[model samples]
Target chain A: MTSPAPLVVGFVAATVLALTAACLLGSTPMGVERVLAALIGSGDAGDRLVVWEIRFPRALAAFLAGSALGASGAALQGLLRNPLAEPGVLGVSATASLAATFFLYYGFVSVAAWGLPVAAIAGALAATALIAFAAVHTRSIITLILIGIGIASFAGAAMSLLMNLAPHPYALSDMINWMLGSVANRSLDDIALAAPFLLCGLVVLYGTRRGLAALTLGEEAAAGVGLNLPRQRLATVLGAGLSTGASVALAGAIGFVGIVAPHIVRPLVAHDPARSLVPSALLAGLLLVLADIGVRLIQSEQELRLGVVAALVGAPVFVWIAVRRQAARD
Target chain B: MTELIATGLTLRVGRATLVDGVSFCLRPGELVALLGPNGAGKSSLLRASLGLQKRSGGTATLGGRDSERLNPVTRARLVSYLPQIRSIAWPNVVRDVVALGRFSHGAAIGTLREADRAAVERALDACDLLHLANRRCDTLSGGELARLHCARAFAAEAPLLLADEPVGGLDPFHQFRVMDITRAFVGRGGGALVVLHDVALAARYAHRLLWMKDGRIVAHGTPDQTLTAERLAAIYGVRACVDGLRVALEGAA
Candidate 1:
């Protein structure tokens, strides 16, 4: 069958808004004519810097972060075979938080400029190793989720300790900013930093679509159908972990996109797990872009973290859908 | 010949030995019914025969190759199996679930061949599940879900199929339809070994019966020879009789 109508509409909206958001959220806001002139490369140097050096990066980060989280959620759910499985539940985001905390607060690294995202990625990989180690007993999705929770909690405790013991005001602020998340001061360098990891994560997630489809039959059954269990598990963990790490590194752990986007797109694909990835990615891009736009329109003097805003909107919707689904199961 | 033959096969689960020294030979174009009381090792034997359970002794051979030694993809092409426990919170449509049987043959698993689609369609049609193709399996009745699985098993188009009580949850109509589809498989030169509870169904559909008791084959022959009242009573501790078309049983063990 052809792609669903909503998917088509979603792509259109995402494309339009991506360009518009690119033009708007720069170093400085410009009028429509300057924005167009900037778009066509005929604008003033300041307008060009505002568009290229500042706004474009933030907009790109929003798109990638949302896509990564969405794909991560979908892949984790498929791997764990639980709808409740999110990036945080998989321990990736929590590990990133812990690593970011350590980099910003405790250590004054030589490459301190790149410490936040680097440490976050290291944390993500560590969490992945821990989860992977713990997940080896029996092939229970519940077991994977439980292991994820343990890692996340452990990372959370470590992060708190680091925050309390931070060296100075600059360190404390850095930890808090990394934890809360923001696209506010992102530059082309920040986007470049996150792009490879997020893009690679998306590629890995895309590669596993069919294997994930086989996963719906359960692990051993998927293996019997000629999928190597270890390989699938590795790809799944890496994909989800990279996405979570990238999101935490650039946007600082935007929650709910991972949970919400997959749930929404999976149904339209008729629960075809293979098709869940790309759709989940696009839908997530739409979601974060809209949420970022909402944050702007609210006009708060105090900056709002993307994660808190998502939780505010996502938790209720998630609960309602979950309750409805649980009712259906019964 | 695409026959499934097992010799001196033994399967153990933990400390419990499920099948000990089981031997059977099932030719293509025939259905062999495995009959046993609960926990008498019918499922274990099927699992062993399908290479889902690693045999502790001897070997199960399909198409002249040791079943366990066949490459995974080749083995998948040679045999398909359906376990008793099926669904687990999957919202996949019935048809997509069936198409998964082609995972081995497809290009890296996402693409399905024209032949694969044809097989899936034929399997779905054979199981009379065309109307429910797009319906989510979670919405299906137990019987319908069982049929959906049967359709998948059929879609696999393996020469040898090991099915554990395939018609267990089906209503009589769908039960017969599943049995008919299974029968059609054998008719088309495929071999099927089915574990079944319904004695009459075994008698009506299977060309041979292997009555298992306490993890051993107590009797193996035609239905009329092996399903005698004495053998039935010995295996199941129940009184059983065949009066004309009716095989009556007063269940105990």
Candidate 2:
């Protein structure tokens, strides 16, 4: 019977620990004292440059992106009342990536620095709207997910087309890197660009927490309890779209963090969907920071993609959960 | 005072009219049972009257406000609904499932308030589930799960309760236990509109009976008047012997 207060305290502590480790344990390692000084603007130029300019932004991006994805996943799972539901399951991330790749292929980056994220968000919204429409028409959860998968496949094909027709070798390589997903080399500007959308998405999802909890009883019962189903649906889909879209725009398709984070924290929150959101977000931020740290630590000829590490670690966990769920059903 | 009032309620889904021109008033201190065969619009009428479904034409009011226009919080406070389908998506504890009733009362997100806790405790006690309050809902037996859902509706402590087959799939003892709880709810100055298939139980427990057929209420009165042999044969196509509160179905008409 782990209560929410203690669980939140534990997660916050863990997040702080992970954040500190991420700042201090990079390729050119800095001592704790130097990291602390750099954080407070009292360290020398090179130390500050290493800590503030490089590692800080990347860690912050990972944290923000993970938090957004985790909150979005929790919200989606609650709304759908399906444990397997995640932002990726809804085709949002794929469509956002497709849009970003579209912009990258056409050299839309020259139009404006914010062009890619804006395009990604727009694509995410469009895909979410399509899925929402399909979901409303279909009562079956399986059908809704199948429709989402269809949309994802369509977007995936479009992305492949963009890659095949990439204008130059450099553009192709950049698209490849973006598709692999990384928070490395990201600047504070990238974080700033994605922050507002992420924050807005978090707020939207947070506001729907109560409604999501009600929905666990099913839609009619939720409505009977005075939950506005349409409004809750809009907030959840739009929020997921915005947060996931922004995350994909900033960090490519970082898979499994959204789905994995909530699964880890769900039982700790006593399976209360509304109570699961904040902890899931915090834990997800921690998970992503640690994963990013792992990306740095793994000695390889070429740097491992953060997304690759997440999926490599996460896919097996997902399969294990599915198997366990099947066993339980039996 | 009237807890729920409906007038000329009609529900149509495309070309089908599930509930047509049905009207009823539920008052405090009364437990009304809605009995009908399948496709007789019992569930649809309840859903439409509660504004959970779109009514083609009519008005339903709860606590003197139009149910269609009532805000969610106020509507939740005025009426509690127990749908026929009983499902707990997650393996939430019994207490948490009951606390969902307080969604409109606020504090649905964080820790429960003192009042909310008291209400949940009271509900658990009423349904005789306090001992199993911490048990995971998915692990509960069918009868226990039925009682748990009853407790969820009871937790709302609203003036009116609309339950669709609240005791369906329960054993005999639990069935009577649930009906007794419904009766007790009305005895304590609340109102209830329950849909039941058991004519004998409805006869024994309900204060009145609303017998429906083909999307219309063919009879609305005391148990004696509504469960007549002629009506039983005509509506349900069953030959039945009725003795006081006990009804025995003999054969198909």
Interface Cα RMSD, each model: 2.9, 1.5
Point out where model 2 deviates above 4 Å. Answer: A27-29
Q: Indicate the residue-level lDDT of B177 in model 2.
A: 89
Per-residue accuracy of model 2 over A1-330 as CA lDDT, tens digit each:
556677789988988878778889777868999998988899788999898889889988888888888898888889888777776767777888888888878778998978888888888888887877877787777887788789888988888888888878988878776677789898999899888888888899889888989988988888888788888889988898888888888888777787898898888888989989988898888898999999998889989998899889877877787688889989
Cα deviation in Å at residue B71, candidate 2? 1.3
TM-score, chain B, model 2, is: 0.97
Evaluate candidate 2 and give its CAPRI docking class based on DockQ: medium
Report fnat for all candidates as fractions from 0 to 1.
0.36, 0.65
lDDT of each model, Cα atoms only?
0.77, 0.86
Task: Name the TM-score of candidate 2.
Answer: 0.96
Instruction: Name the runs in model 1 displaced over 4 angstroms.
Output: A2-13, A39-42, A108-119, A125-147, B53-57, B69-71, B107-113, B242-246
lDDT at B179 for candidate 2? 88
